[model samples]
Target: MLITEKKHGIRFAQRMSDLGTETAFVVLAKARQLESQGRTIVHLEIGEPDFETPAHIVDEAVRALKAGATHYGPSPGLPEARQAIARYVSETRRVPVDFERVVITPGAKPIMFYTILALVDEGDEVIYPNPGFPIYESVIRFVGGRPVPIQLHEENDFRLDVGELLDLVTDRTKLIIINSPQNPTGSILTAEDLEAVGRLALDRDIYILADEIYSRIIYEGDFTSILHVVPEAMDQVILLDGMSKTFAMTGWRLGWGVMQPTLAAAVAKLQTNSNSCTATFSQMVIPPALFGPQGPVEAMRAEFQRRRDAIVAGLNRIDRITCRKPAGAFYVFPNTSRLGVDSQTLADRMLQEAGVAALSGTAFGRFGEGYLRFSYANSIENIKLGLERVEAFVAKL
Candidate 1:
């Protein structure tokens, strides 16, 4: 007898239905498939850095591995790694962060997952930005919390509207997710904006999860953390950051969270039950990556700024497409509403016809329907080529 669904019962739990996916990875697979079929795809679909890991950071990890540093570490993280994160956060944010408050995970994502799991009760609400990271909503729903989306307007350059966000709050609201130098849109929230949000969270006694993974990838101005603005509300804030964007260490899978010691204990317990701990050698890389030469990171940011400028200019010259120069990150969310096609259809047509791999804005959320997101993480030549293909495809419409 064949093993078939009809012959054997196989079902996912109820919460599985509510879980969503990050469509960038899905588009990447399709792009790779097309490439395997001999199509030349200019990939702007994923947000990963195109650079290699810095030499020093890689050397540190290698040294640790060679010296037999591979062992089961503490659930929260190796003590030295946690201490380095504490120092990094304290110095950078100008807020004193105790080492006890830091918890390391495989990547920045687990911080999001663990924070939601530990804090959100079923029926509690989480207010997060739409056209934001899909996993924010995905993990929110996975843990049985209601996801309340706050629309990010293109007119406002995709910054979160504090007034509008205030309207979404309810007694059941447990946490608010803030992603500055945000994904997809690449907008940075102002210090005043962070102050307002911090005040709201403090007054309402709700938690604020600040996802600042892209803090080191900024352009044009200083990057501000919520903790910097509201050090008084340290207990109410959870800071999420990682080496993926900064040091081109996505493959290394190292990230961390900084919170109050009590909540850190809770998140660490969750880590114990789940991932146990991050890799020991990877943990050893933290001190060097944070305190080592800053030259490599600055070079990457400068290059990304160059790519951002080129992509924005190219997209603007195309008919019916208007793009804003993002303040940070490596994405340009161009408005395609004037082209009279839904974002998903436009994205699909671009991929199938033009060999350009980009994401429909709807992949972020329903509010993203009129837009499309293209990561400028590729080379300037590839970015220009993708723009040409997009323009040619849009002209046909």
Candidate 2:
């Protein structure tokens, strides 16, 4: 029988207490609870893509399963799958992606863990964005690394201030995280900005952990990848990417980390010990997904662009809520602080009383205070309804 607190008085490790969680999942659970109580919630909380995984990718997975590809495989990933990822990254980042330097994991998440853990010793300082993805902060803390947050500016359209970022770096700083077409804010860093960070990392000999999951979900201007910006300094780079956002394959749980050969080998060993590779059948479908026609992918991006416009326009109509037009990704973070209300209160009231689901900006970071994130990943009808209810609720308050 499995040991449990009830049965054996199990004392969890002390480290477990230090771990943090993604509040999006917490908000999702609460939304579900209210939904079960017969509330009609127009969900704008989670960043999930409501679209189905493309038919071609689905067909490939089905074919792989039928062909008896359901067993455990190499932890670093199948050779053909790695080659396909290498091709995609090489084309997108303009860096010569070595297939051997790619280590496949269940999702982009594992790459974050592996890369951070591989580079960060206890007491090492890591610089990540404030008001950025919550998991980056959570994982750094969980691993005993000192997380130094660089506050992203709203006046700068949520772009990282190169001066501020460089000032925070010190001898203790080991890694700096770069997430373009970033989460929550949907801000894309400029190519020049990326090159500046690359120069800093090169001078300090610090690693750059680049999260480029939403590279293909871009709408305005171009997506400037870190590898493409400073290809010469790639030795200090670790690229994290996957199919979840781009291909609407969130549940497929497939992602890869591209790094120097030594780090890739170490990550593979870590994966072999822990995750034991992505599902065998999922790996079989990756090459087809990478090399196949991209009509469905382009269609999805166009639709997201349309939704992005609707949400930004709708939120702007509410005088108290000022949402910037995002360049990429599918979220709009509006400043609700103009109304003299905390983000948590506004988000909870919208869900519990107004039947609209949204996340408080504080759920991301303290720097995200005075803001609220609304995901446009849902349908246009629902996005309109969700924002309408929010507008009505804010009007009453």
Candidate 3:
């Protein structure tokens, strides 16, 4: 094989240069490398659950495949799957969404990207949480929108301050992204905060992108949705969720977006130009995942709670390490400022010296500079060992 450079001056979009990336997969690759070299690495990097997909859900998918439900269904989604999602949202979250307004996609990420592309324009502004999901910023920049961050601080339990968020919004602000039981920090937005955001969205005539992917994974109080507080805002709000986090079906590549009919049609057009539609068999399994027995989801939540307790308690015991007990999701964002080093240095030292894999909080955004994110998706035993390794590493510092 010969390697040669392109002869012509190949032009690329300038926006591509400003795009960012998610670092969880990068850390996961490094962890696998260490494991291959005979190092026993306990992975707490990626935010995936340790549970298998519920038996009934898997069986449903198999049944669909065997029944020859493998042809391309619809550009938006199979009508049945869309209706199931509409019912699930209405019954579970008390969010009234019409079936015609739902567009199913391969995963939540694609919906997010499409939403950014639809609302963002050159020099427009998009607001998102700092130390949050990196893709929010990545896609915003990919669409040539200026990313304005809503800084979620540890003092505030990583919750978005409504007033501060509103202050950042201006006439050019096209979209605001909100994530509850958020990635990395695992902080849930309070009902009051949601109401405040909804009111602002209504008053400002700005669009809201509510990411409820982890809505069902809460360990504390009831899960809330922005759509519940301001139903009229539904016309301007886009809700993105799926079976990935709730049903432990991440690899199945299934998710759906809820928006107004016009916005849904626009996203559907984008989907038609891009992926066409989610896999037919996967769409066939969504109804069972949403309406079937929910015991497996509850069991997964309980296990995550156990691991969360173990890791939080263990980190608190370790010197020069401080971790807040996350109220939802499967991550613990701990302040490593007491260690007198940045998050990246601490993460590197932990991976290289202790053979433990965790993400540098800074990888999410600059607001995460002095923190590290530990995903509690593994077993209790592995969490214990990982904490032990972290303790040893911190002690040496």
Best by TM-score: 1
The true-versus-predicted C-alpha distance at residue 12 of model 1, in Å, is 1.2
Best by lDDT: 1
- Give the least accurate 10-residue stretch of model 2, judged by summed lDDT: 1-10
lDDT tens digits, residue span 1-397, model 2: 5545356565899778767878888888999998898888888888878999999899999999999998989889999999999998898888898899898899899999899888898899999988999888888888899999998889999999999997899999999998989998999999889999999999999999999999999997678898888998898999999989989988999999999999999999999889778898998888888889899889999999999999899999986889899999888889998888898998888888899888899888899999999889899999888878888888988
Model 2 misplacement above 4 A: 1-10
Give candidate 2's TM-score.
Answer: 0.97
lDDT of each: 0.93, 0.90, 0.90
TM-scores for all candidates: the values are 0.98, 0.97, 0.97
Error of 1 at 143 (Å): 1.3
Positional deviation of residue 388's Cα in model 1 after best superposition, in angstroms: 1.3
How many clashes (backbone N, Cα, C below 3 Å) per candidate? 1, 0, 0
Taking the tens digit of each residue's C-alpha lDDT, what string does model 3 give over 128-245? 9999999999998888889999999999999998879978988998889999989989999998998998888889888999999999889888888987787778888899999898
lDDT of 1 by residue, 224-322 (tens): 999889989899999999999999999999999999999999999999998899999999999989999999999999999999889999999998899
Superposed Cα deviation of residue 79, candidate 1 (Å): 0.4
